[model samples]
Target: MGIEAGVAGAVLGRVGASERVVACTAAARAAGVRRGQRRRDAQRLCPELVVAERDLDAEGRAFETVAAAVAELTPRVEVVRPGVCAIPARGAARFHGGEEALRITVQDAVVEAGYDCGVGIADGLFAAELAARNGGGGLIVPEEGSAEFLARFPLSVLAGAVPDWDSLADLLVRLGVGTLGEFAALPADDVAGRFGAPGVLAHRLARGREPRDVAPRAAPPDLTVVRAFDPPAARSDEVVFAAKALADTLHEGLAAEGLTCVRLGVEVEFADGGVSERLWRHEGLLSSQAVAERVRWQLSGWRPAFTGDGTEAEEAVWGGVTALLLVPDQVVPDTGVQRALWGRDGDGARGELPERVARAADRVQAMLGHGSLTRPHLTGGRGPGERVLRVPVGDMPLETRPEGPWPGALPAPAPSVVPPEPRPVAVRAADGSPVTVSARCVPSAPPAVVVMPDGSGHRVISWTGPWPAHERWWDPESSRRLARFQVLTPQGAHLLTLEQGSWLLEASYE
Candidate 1:
């Protein structure tokens, strides 16, 4: 009756059942079995159906997987629903030989991916869907027979699978329309007057008339170069070397074509069954230096968790980076356009900012390693602590800033320093005496601090009041309160706190 149920149906189909056992057809389609269905009716239909609640997130992920599998055939794949996708065939058909071959290829891919799917090809989306539905398992509606094929289908077919089919049938019979042919013969004006626009449209469709056309898919730029490894690479350094060579090859090709690539795609395959991909882009033509920097950035950013004498790490490197492909998602003409390099002008210098930044990031990555350099990002929360955070540098937008400066809050422009490992520090009372902390301690009194390993005590210079912070007050299972203070010591400025009344150093500016 509405888009909600259609979306819910697609979500349910993707989630399916989670018990690892096959569900009976009746049980699987029971009310409440799908999203937005009533729970009581679903239980009544199949008591032993092993009903599993729908997982929208998992369903969405699975839908993407299916769409990616389809992308192997054609780059233009539109996911209409969790279980349904639409692919324009004019170009794909020509590339694969013919329409039949394209259909077969799609069918084979779906089957191989462990999905039971139906594919339909026609001049329009509606006709293609009808072809798919009528084909049962898999169907192809030929260009010439599209009109003839749709004519025999009843008006009910266009209504989709709704619950009130009997009521609709009764209404049709009351109107003296029993067959699709009879309904088609009705005048569009009369149908519109009686049942509205949807009815008139239904009449037109039954008579084999559709007024839509296939939309053309957008084509990417024309520069592309690929390199396949003879044997898989395993080490990060080896992968970097290979990527460097591949970048050179791509640069040479682009130079010869008199074009420049603004975007790059990197794909990696692992020996122990793993795959990773990354996309990179530049605002202008990628120079040789820029290309090399991109390759290094990609390699440095990847880290795999495994234990060995560095042999496994080496083997896990891009030695297995068997294939490397660079595609120009965007391109610009190399016209000899130039501006005077005088008064208030340096267009060339202004244009080189992207390349300079990229090069700088690459150098830092080479020296410090990937995941070390990062940019601040705003997290999706209103709290002071959650307002801003940091993520891998290149992975997120660079200009992302904090929501606003919070008064009486932690200092702005957080430290660029990051410790390899946390160094434990001993805290002391004003009398140079170690204080013991306990959960039952009153907030009015200060708690003791002790350094790890050796119990050395440091004197507190100045201290602020215990600002108590309580969170998750409504949830008893997660409720917690902490008393914090900015305590200055001879050694450094530190933020000391009693978390749930247990003494710990929250942070330090040394």
Candidate 2:
């Protein structure tokens, strides 16, 4: 999309909530940009790298073309995400000549639709995804060859296969289990014992098995939740917002039966009798948030057909959404989630709250909206104030400490108090002259006294250097130059900054 918008260079990246390179183009890969690399680091590596925030709505709308094209070859095209999808190979291949022929036909179909795609067939979805990403515009893994095909790949390939797998991959590497084959060679029981449930799942993937073990059982009750908008909803946001509660109800119903679905069906009915439907797949169980997100994408992707004369066709035009339905498919046993041993959440925060407390917070948020409750998150910056960001509860923060090194960052033992606003004060030398720092970062005099805005004075017992910093020097508009000093007053220690000849208290050490 950025390329189509005339963004310079083919080196492009999709930045995620963490402001990291969630996905990048081939040119970006060639330029040493990889997934999870911070935005700044990626720009540094490829100076012309064009980055855009990940827009699921736009991606969903764009992918509708590919999905429609693929549906011509196969009826059921399970959309894994905006860019990836899967189809049952056996039946589709037989109807389209052969597996190889089907792959070519599918790829050509999408290409003819003004999009390029890779088609790969394997025993399981995981292996098929890997095969699709293989070189040579993707390749088909031969029957029962998934294990062998995956063996040569390093454990790092499992990084994004599931949540928290990166850390597990690192641990496996340190244990001399460098490749899929090595990790697969370990006994499943031992892997479970040593690494617990997540290890078992990873081992299954390594051994070319489906990520989830299907324990076949009788189909549960219909776990469909529907919402009818009185008078119909003309705006997409109205329906999208309602999807959250609908999804929540669906999940609650499924939870009551100890069941979950691998695939979800989102069907929307328009007042004009028009219908829009899509299938979303998740190897693991989808949360309520996940379901609602897919709903948003589906709505964003929907479009009415046009007449031959470039005018909106009356039959194709949708008046408004009259009803919305969520149908759970491929239901399976809910094996439950494994809690982190250290009680840490996805963002590396020890965020596990008591069940009651968590419920209370969720209820409060539901009543007051997303931003009513928030928590502080640590981020990358030099000053204590800049290092922390407040994020809404249940929201993931976009910044992290690994973004890049802060060359002039403050030393360890951060201040205990960081004021919301700058507190201007006077730092005077013994002779009553205001203490000033030169452009060379040299202080005119060392000993000084502090005068607060309230007209209170405190004697400075000791002090640290007038460390100077030049930040964002390349950008003339946002650049800042300042000198900092840690002064120990008789009352307490304070972090003071000298910028443009004015002194402000930034933080205070307890």
Candidate 3:
């Protein structure tokens, strides 16, 4: 977007879904702004940074330009992301004279189209990506030299190439495994035993091996599923709604044969006779809901490219979608799950129940809005309200509770009911006087009775606490100083807070 709009100087694009910086120009990177940093943190790093909300549609359109330029050389282009892509180079290399010649030709094409890119060739996709990023202009790794070429890089590189490797990478660093070569040297069996599947995959990549074999058995002919709209669906949601059912059917077909696809291809045919297609990667088999989300993202990114004028503004008047197709790529035999030996239905209601819940959530979210359904995640805080956060169902949990201990936090057996907002109530002493907390964190008197806002009273059977907390004292705008108490009454147990001479019912223990 910065390039298209000609807005130069420290530009960063943040994904709204995660509220994290997903892409940044070289200027921002040089200024110490990195991807995954919060928007505020990035802004702080580069005060003059120009932040832009990412538009999947624009990304889809811009990549079309890049893909078109590359497709001129080879038709088998596979996009890893909006800014990165791959192609089987052996055939293209031979056709274009050699690897070096092919690399030069691909780079020249993209540069001529007003974009800069690096071309790289290696034994596997992972090494090739590193080569493209690290190689100046372009570099071609000689056959059988991928492992040697990857040895010099740090273990941190694996975190970017593989999913869920960040924590593992950090652990490796702490254990003196600083480089890829060191990690690769570990016994494969030991790595598997310690880290399970993710570690094994990372170790394979570190050794210059692709996560899976290149020539996976082709999916059976009947695996591809298609749905055609009668009048050509005009709205994107209409297609998305259909995708959910299609994905369910596709998964069922795959399950019947005990198979799963590591990569999925979503194809959309416009009424104007233009076809938009993209490949999505999911190492852990894609769920039905996950497939529908990919379709939605593909549509969002494809809208501008589908427009006649190739502009976002003109997309509203573009042709409708006529048909949709789903093709499972990289078909492999599924390593089926082992059922629990003790109880048939183990913990968390495993099996069809979760899928049913996910489908129900999808429909509800479609009818309402994305934020209509949410799940609570625990995070670092001294109070029950501060410790819990509610986020939309499908969003990634960007924030996590720190492993460190909180000095003033409450003990175990957390509250069962945390209201959206605190409800004000009165806490009275035995003589009907209001209860208060002193400067030394001592209660004025034992809380004898709790009064509801409606004037009803519940006699306190037992009481504990004056757990005081001083939080964020440096930030006056958000600073908080409060005292909390737990009181058991005839009706139920309640978590109460006293601040500024008033008591508020914070939560209740069932």
| Candidate achieving the largest lDDT | 2
Q: Model 3, range 179-286, lDDT digits (tens) per residue?
A: 888888999999999988878988999899988766656547679999999899988878888998999899889989888877888888989988777776765467
> What is the descending TM-score order?
2, 3, 1
Candidates' C-alpha lDDT: 0.54, 0.78, 0.77
**lDDT per residue, candidate 1, 1-510, as tens digits?**
112221212222211111121121222442334333333444555464444445433343445556657877887665444456777799999999998889889978987876656678886666786676454445777676655777676554553322233345568888777766777777778877976645665666666566322345455345566666667665555665666677777777666766666556556655655555444444345555555555544443344434465443423453356666666554544553243322111221222324566678778988998777775554433223444466665564444333322233444433233343334455555455544443443433343444532456555666654555566679999996665566666766566555643566555665
What is the Cα-based lDDT of residue 183 in candidate 1? Answer: 79
- Runs with alpha carbons beyond 4 Å of true place in candidate 2: 4-18, 26-34, 37-48, 226-245, 269-275, 283-290, 305-323, 335-374, 383-385, 391-402, 408-510
Question: Candidate 2: global Cα-lDDT?
Answer: 0.78
Order of the predicted models by lDDT, top scorer first:
2, 3, 1
lDDT, candidate 3, equals 0.77
* Collision pairs in model 2: none
Per-residue lDDT over 1-510 for candidate 2, one digit per residue giving the tens place of the 0 to 100 score: 464322322322322224566566655655766665667777889898877777666677678778767877777878988888888999998998999999889989987988755678899988897787666467999999999999997776665565567567768878889899999999999999998767888899999999766677776898899999889987777887899889889888988998888888888998888777778887666766678777766665454556578985422325788999998867777887654432355524243554677788899999999899887777778888988888887777765664347777888899999999879999999999999887777899875799976789989999997777899899999999988899998799999998988999999999
Q: What is the lDDT of candidate 1?
A: 0.54
lDDT of 3 at 307: 48
Supply candidate 1's per-residue lDDT for 474: 96
Instruction: Enumerate residue pairs that collide in model 3.
Output: none
